[model samples]
Target: MSNNPMNMMFAWMKIASSYNQMMLSSSEVIVRRTMMMASGTMTLPDAMSMMMEKGTIYATATERAAVAMASGADPAKITAAALKPYSTKTQSNVRKLRG
Candidate 1:
């Protein structure tokens, strides 16, 4: 076997760093995605308050949000409405992070 010691070390380090970056990026994505999804879901207070205040609306938070989305409205409007209920600043933030 031919030996190229310096090249092998450089190649290995490059690969390792790239792999580490990938892992970090993926974990961040998962956390952020889950959080965004959570926003679309209803919280306990939202559920209880909606139930007590609006008897006609579904008691489940997520189900209510789903119904709103299914009503053939604009997606941006839907996302905008959902963003305020959650801590995320904007829906575009998620897309920026993804890229």
Candidate 2:
């Protein structure tokens, strides 16, 4: 990421947008999964798989953030790194669920 203030601001804006998108996708996933469960299409193992996937995703993001902080990354870079996995996963989930 550029060190320019304007560029940093844009980066933050992008991150914020990504965060909102992730949240929206997450909500959609939850609702869809609930509906699936209600209709007996989603089983306990499927729900457990979703939970495990979430845990893995969170752990990966946390590890990335920790590594970035240990390396003395700038605040914006650290946040961007942390958000990357979440953004990628949620975007993927959105597409998969839509299909």
Candidate 3:
């Protein structure tokens, strides 16, 4: 209801800040869950690789969600975008695996 452009800007900034906080908390939860899910069968290097890949996926989702929300996009769309990066097909490994 605020007609002042500055007020609207501040309001959006608040929303962005809140989104960032939530994203960070969610990312922590994600990392914790990933660690918990790693069984004793995995090697140290393999576990670290899995953790790093999952963390990157989590981070990318949050970053995209923040950008979408800051751009005045629909919140539902933002949430969906955050969930989008979870698919394994979206991930890429920079390190080449030589058998």
Candidate with best TM-score? 2
* 1-99: candidate 2 lDDT, tens digit per residue: 558999889878988988898899889888888889889898788788888888899899999999999999878878988998988887787787778
* Model 2 lDDT-worst window of ten: 89-98
**TM-scores, all models, native as reference:** 0.40, 0.85, 0.43
lDDT at residue 14 of model 3 (Cα atoms): 63
Once fitted onto the true fold, the runs of candidate 2 whose alpha carbons sit more than 4 angstroms away are: 1-3
The global C-alpha lDDT for each of the candidates, from Candidate 1 onward, is 0.48, 0.86, 0.59
Ranking by TM-score: 2, 3, 1
Query: Which regions of candidate 3 fall more than 4 Å away from where they truly are?
Result: 1-44, 88-99
Q: Is candidate 1 or candidate 2 better by TM-score?
A: 2
In candidate 3, which residue pairs clash?
none
Q: State each model's C-alpha RMSD to the native.
A: 17.9, 1.7, 10.3
> Model 1, 1-99: lDDT tens per residue?
124666656655654655555455546755775675578764676446434633322234345456668975444334434333332222333455566
lDDT of 1 at 5: 69
Per-residue error at 46 for model 2, in Å?
2.0
RMSD of 2: 1.7
lDDT by residue (tens digit), candidate 3, 4-87: 677666656765665665566556545554554674444678568756876788789889899989988665557656765653
